[model samples]
Target: MEKAKEMVVGIKELSSLPAVYHQVRGVLDNADSSIIDLANVVSVDAAITARLLHVVNSVYFGLMSRVDTVSRAVSILGMQQVHDIVLATSVSAMFKGMSPANMNMTRFWSNSVMRALIARTGAEMVRAGELERFFVAGLLSDLGHLVMYEVEPKLAEQAQMLSVQSGRPLHELERELLGCDYAEVGAALVDKWHLPPRLGAAIAGQIEPALADELYRRDAAMLNLARIMTDAMEQKMESEAIAELFDESIWTLSGLKPANVATIRLIAEMNHGEVVTLFFPQLRPAG
Candidate 1:
């Protein structure tokens, strides 16, 4: 863990979230902050404005009409939701160039968006509060892999190959070879970014939620299922095959059922392209 922390901290790219995100977060944390204050901070960045407007108008939100201005968006979506949207978009931008030689950025973001939607779906299905928080946590769950690949691409590749050959858990191979897995590295990055501690806790314990604190285990369990579901989708695995990969107790933890997995996976698959387009309008389909 120490080595992973050192590696992530030393990397310029992953060390901090974009400054604008921090500024917005400052207002979100301040009791005196108003919707206007948050709007002003967001409006400074044209890209975030466009993305925020696009998202609020997108079918994802299912707003009746277009939301044209940041101020209007603030009034409509409320501070909590807007903060998440801006942070999500800004984080996407922050890691825009973090693709390792071994991984494709298009595929990376696509998987993240899928996992995020799946997590949100899980949150709704389970009646877990704050769907957006689960979405962001799921989106960032795999971030540690970016740091690992950046610090040691060849070793990362080797771990992947070994996992494929051995039929063992990849995180196991990653920890054995790299001194830490993506979950640990991701947790470290989440801490450095000063995100909600739950986000970090969930990421850190995703591979083994049982090891996390009792309170966070529930959210971590949701993320764990979301990750497995997303990976199965990315690999184009069938539902039965995916079923074989699930933790029997995770469904219970998520307040879902075995049958529900099929439904959630189906919905996630159907929505994958549109959600990808929703978050990454600039990206084209990876053919």
Candidate 2:
């Protein structure tokens, strides 16, 4: 784990979050932080501000009135919600212009968006109120693989191939091949970013919620279920095999019913394309 963290640090491309992201975070760290403080820092990035308002006004939120300004968006969503939006937006932007030749960036983002939506549905099924956190956690859960493919493409490729060849989970193969899996790498990177600790924790525990502290277990469980459902949705696993991949403990721990599986997948797939376009329009080629 220590070596994996060090490897992530050595990668220059993902060294830091955007400046505005850090600035907003610094204000968020201050208890006296207000909507104005968030608006001040976020407005500097016109693109983020625009997306923030768009999402605030989108069918996703279903707001009754127009939200034309970052301040109005912040007031409507509250500081914490706005910060999560900023975190999601800035994190998405950080990966822009990174056209890694080997990685299918579009497919990667599609899977992420799908996972995020599925996670949100699962959160709702389980009655977890922190839906945005669940969405962000699922959206970024696979990011560690990006770091691995960036810094050690050959080894990462080997691990991916082995998973397909051996019929074992990728995380298991990653441990054997790289000494750490995407969950650990993603968690370490999230921790380094200084976002919410539980976000990092939930991602870190995607493979096993018990790996996270008690406070974050519910979110972690939600993330784990979402990943499994994404695999099932993408046909990465067979219908019969899908049930096997589910962590039964998540059902017990999260109160999310298996009966909700079809409904969750439907909702995730329904909005996935739109959500992908909203968050990563770069993935779409020239129209």
Q: What's the lDDT for candidate 1?
A: 0.84
- Looking at model 1, residue 217 earns an lDDT score of 87
* TM-score (C-alpha) between model 1 and the true structure: 0.94
**How high is the lDDT of residue 150 in model 2?**
82
Provide the lDDT at 161 for model 2. 90
- Compared with the true structure, what per-residue lDDT tens digits does model 1 show for residues 1-287? 79778868878877677777889889989999999999999999898898889888887788988889999999988887888888788887777756688987788788888888888888888788778888888888888888887888999989999999999999999889988899999998888889989889999989888778888988898889888988877788877787677777786667777667778887777877877887776676988
Over 1-287, each residue of candidate 2 has an lDDT whose tens digit, in order, gives 89579768977778788888888888889999888988988999988888888778877777999989888888888877787777788878889877555788888888888889988888887678867878889889989988888877888899999888989889998888889999999988988877788888889888898667988888888888888878776775544556566667888766776677777877887887777877887887322
Candidate 1 clashes between residue pairs 3 or more apart in a chain or in different chains: none
Stretches of model 2 off by over 4 angstroms after superposition: 236-244, 285-287
